[model samples]
Target chain A: MNITLAQARQVVAGALAAGRAASYKPLTVVVLDSGGHVVAVEREDGASTKRFEIAHAKAHGAVALGLGSRALMARAEQQPYFIAAVTQTVGALVPVPGGVLVRDADGGLLGAVGVTGDTSDHDELAALAGIEAAGLVGQPD
Target chain B: MNITLAQARQVVAGALAAGRAASYKPLTVVVLDSGGHVVAVEREDGASTKRFEIAHAKAHGAVALGLGSRALMARAEQQPYFIAAVTQTVGALVPVPGGVLVRDADGGLLGAVGVTGDTSDHDELAALAGIEAAGLVGQPD
Candidate 1:
């Protein structure tokens, strides 16, 4: 399933809107194409400056591995040695939560999204809103 | 203008929690001190592998310039030549929106937070939430 840049941008916009409505705080959002290239980005005022890179990295990890950051974190816990080795081999493997895979209506891989700040759960919530806005399905809770 | 490691951890944890509650795919959150040093990090399940680096880069940009990533993006657009030169000078510079700066109640710089995955706007929201949870103010929204 091809993920259109337009859809990704919509998702990001929706997520930001949701955050604002909830008064959750400023946020940084990122969208990546299926190929892991950055499609769009947004950084709210009052947000930290590093959020852009962090969001991209998280999205990149999801798109590259076809898995969420949470799963990677679990794997790291189960196999610290392997995770460490992989970390060394792959200079950019971040086993953190907040990265999610974007799937089309038919469950085909479309792209990925990453968010940071607030709680992981909150970040996830904003992402979920964005995915829904994009007419995509996120992994089950 | 000093950011403590404890504050960094708090920001990350809060961001992670927010993401989880929202049922986002997964994520990685990171906090950096004013000096652009990593103070805390967390990776959740299903998050992307590259989030670590992205987070670092985003936060680095915020701290380095004392501006939000979105502002930086504007600058990049207005002066692509200068941005290109800056990127070349700083190998890790990514002038995208998603990073935010953290400040104290008195408006003193504390550090920055970077997030990845969903969208730049979403990432910024999560970071803002984390900063608020840490009892600090994000820059003016």
Candidate 2:
């Protein structure tokens, strides 16, 4: 099933709330449909403006490559030139841990969520929290 | 005060509601802070994937030039080359009516709201409605 706008909002809210609860730096959250189109995005009041673009790029990279950004990070380490080419081709991409794939119970692709703030690992945890809050599974790898 | 994520979401919700109430096609709404950075963006399910980019460009142009998109459209008609050059320099800009400048009571620039889906006029109207719904001023011209 496709992720609806409502669910996307919930994901964003959950991610931000998680960040706040963890006392992380202000976070930006983006939810992208399976097609890599933006469903919704929210940048916290004090978050750096660039966080929005970074968050979107993370989600876009995950959806476009059909792999969680964590996996992409590993690939980038093994094939830096390839990841660089892909980033150039995609306009914007960040091979990092904060981008997570969303799936249904049967492992159907739904969409993806990207969170940015604090540490990358903390960002990924918030993303997973958001996906679960929206009743979807988050695949970080 | 700056436009918070909460207010940006309100603006997007208001714009989409306005479009639906007017029986317009699916719409994409984007909110940009005064720095021309994205604050929030939402694309309706049926909106074309490109709508997000269009909407962001519209708002970006407004925030970048300190003029509403309707005014930009007029300038474009008078000096096509200037507008074209600016678009190229800015990387992305839409000199159309849908981009609206947002302001506070004292005429302080707060941000901008952009909407894309229906006719340019309808899009501008929706953007205005959204700004008003969020208790901010929308300068369409």
Best by TM-score: 2
> What's model 2's lDDT at B103?
90
Off by over 4 Å in 2: none
DockQ (0 to 1) for model 1: 0.06
- Cα lDDT tens digits, model 1, A21-127, are 88876778888878887788898876655567666766666776678867766765577565456545543544566678889878888888887666556777888
Tens-digit lDDT track for model 1 on B1-141? 678888888888888777767766566777878767888888777777898888777777777556777777786676443344334333365667658888888887888788877677777778878888889988622
Candidate 1 off by > 4 Å? B1-105, B108-141
DockQ of 2: 0.83
Q: Pick the candidate with the highest lDDT.
A: 2
TM-score per candidate, in order?
0.53, 0.96
Q: Which candidate is the best by DockQ?
A: 2
Q: Interface Cα RMSD per model, in Å? A: 11.5, 1.0
Residue B91 lDDT in candidate 2: 67
Residue A111 shift from truth in candidate 2, angstroms: 1.7
Pairs in steric clash, model 2: none
Kindly list the per-residue Cα lDDT of model 2 for residues B14-60, writing each as its tens digit.
89889989999888999998898888988887888788899998999
